[model samples]
Target: MRQTRFHGRVEGAAACCSVPGCSEPGEFRAPVTPSSFDGPGSFRWLCLDHVRQFNSAYNFFAGMTPDEIEAAQSPTAGWERQTRAFASNGGDPMPSWGDFSDPLDAISARFRPTAKRQAVERFSGAERHALGVLGLKDDTDLHSVRRRYSDLVRRYHPDRNGGDRRHEKKLGQVIEAWQTLKIARAFA
Candidate 1:
């Protein structure tokens, strides 16, 4: 039972061909030194016919500079300005906190007005038709429209319906619906 086809080789590697009378088995790697004072770069291996004669005389821009080999053969290689596209709502076009007083807090401020004053005097289409002619609603107030216009003027007062002058035209329409709810409470 023997099988052997070491493709890009390195299997259980204790490699050997650091090229001294090569006993073969080094499975290929290469650069043992170019410039690593003492850390990350070290590899020699080389046995597939001296790693194909050291990758046919490897010279990756060897001693660079013809404008560094035309800026390393740039098709925008390493893209000059680091290959654009970042602006998702660009930035720093200036406004980086020019006195960002917690969003212009104009000094210990307190602006409470997102619609109030009794919700703009309880919705006004003529104070909602004078709180529907005093049967009151729009959150009634002016002292509950003077207590529902004095209880509809004592229930259509004509001597309380005894001296009944036919409810005196319903007590002059409850005194003209309490003078249009006291002139719509001075404009609601």
Candidate 2:
């Protein structure tokens, strides 16, 4: 028995080119890959010449403004900003989004970077402690700090913690801590 080399379908809508009576087996897979944000994924069935023409005329960034184009084309800017290594606590810089014993408290504490009127007061100082907890040295490079921060943020993010409203505040605090540290560290 001979095995068929092509496992793809060549019948019905997938069978022929949409170009009138062209009876060639649609050789190319033209599935449109959509953005992860779920915009659109409509595939086109075209013959070689038509496919080439479509490719030539297609402008993926058609509707965007000049500013949008410029911004999107530029390297990500916020990654280089300072964080909290200058807190005078003598601890290492905090991981980007370090883990916490309580996520609800973390999220709630984000709003209070200053010293008063908040459950987790002195978040700037707490941020310094988080860096110490992560075991990063005060002199650690930005690259290492960001990498560790990303790791902890992913682990404790409230969104990924399965609908625990309690964790939401904590997650926010964790984020705030990282942001404070990142900005302070960047400038200092």
Candidate 3:
């Protein structure tokens, strides 16, 4: 096959140029009408020389107002138009990372189970009961559980409570619950 010199030349084109009185092979495409919302409109085949002439005379802003022309020429023209938001998270509420000092903390918080979820989904029956005994929530971390245990011990212990034997039974129960929860898989 013979190759034409121009970049957009139609290979093996048999149609004659659309330009009147021109017998050259129609190797280039030119728009027959302005494009619209429907589509790119129609095209006319032209020879190299005639296509160059058509291009030279074509004015993209021919019927546009000065303001329209200015807007079209602006760097941020197309960007000003609002675009459809992507449904990336399957309709989940978007995290407000700007409100957080560390954006990763916001993301972590979003994925982390809530106290209710932990109680229902993660903790076993005994673990849940132990958590209740320690006066800690199912969502409480190991550190918080340890702190609560220490606080309860101080509050109920005979030595810490000024040798009061009245709370010894409550203190024993607290200690037993702490022992059970300390080695629990949920806390670990």
Evaluated at residue 152, the lDDT of candidate 3 is: 93
Q: Taking the tens digit of each residue's C-alpha lDDT, what string does model 2 give over 1-188?
A: 96444334334445566567777656444656754667657665766555566568888579999887877677884565688665555543333333334556555555454555333232346556766755566556557767877876776776677755665665566666567577553334
Candidate 1 local Cα displacement, residue 135, angstroms: 46
TM-score (all chains, Cα) for each model = 0.23, 0.30, 0.52
Please write out the lDDT profile of model 3 over residues 50-138, one tens digit for every residue. Answer: 99998899988999999999999998989988999887766445445543445676677566655422212456677788889888886
| lDDT agreement with native, every candidate | 0.65, 0.58, 0.80
Model 3, residue 63: C-alpha shift (Å): 2.5
lDDT value, residue 66 of candidate 1: 89
Clashes of 1: 0
Instruction: Measure candidate 3: CA RMSD.
Output: 9.2
Query: Candidate 1: where are CA atoms >4 Å away?
Result: 1-12, 15-22, 25-56, 61-82, 89-95, 101-188
Q: How high a TM-score does candidate 2 get?
A: 0.30
* Best-fitting candidate, scored by lDDT: 3
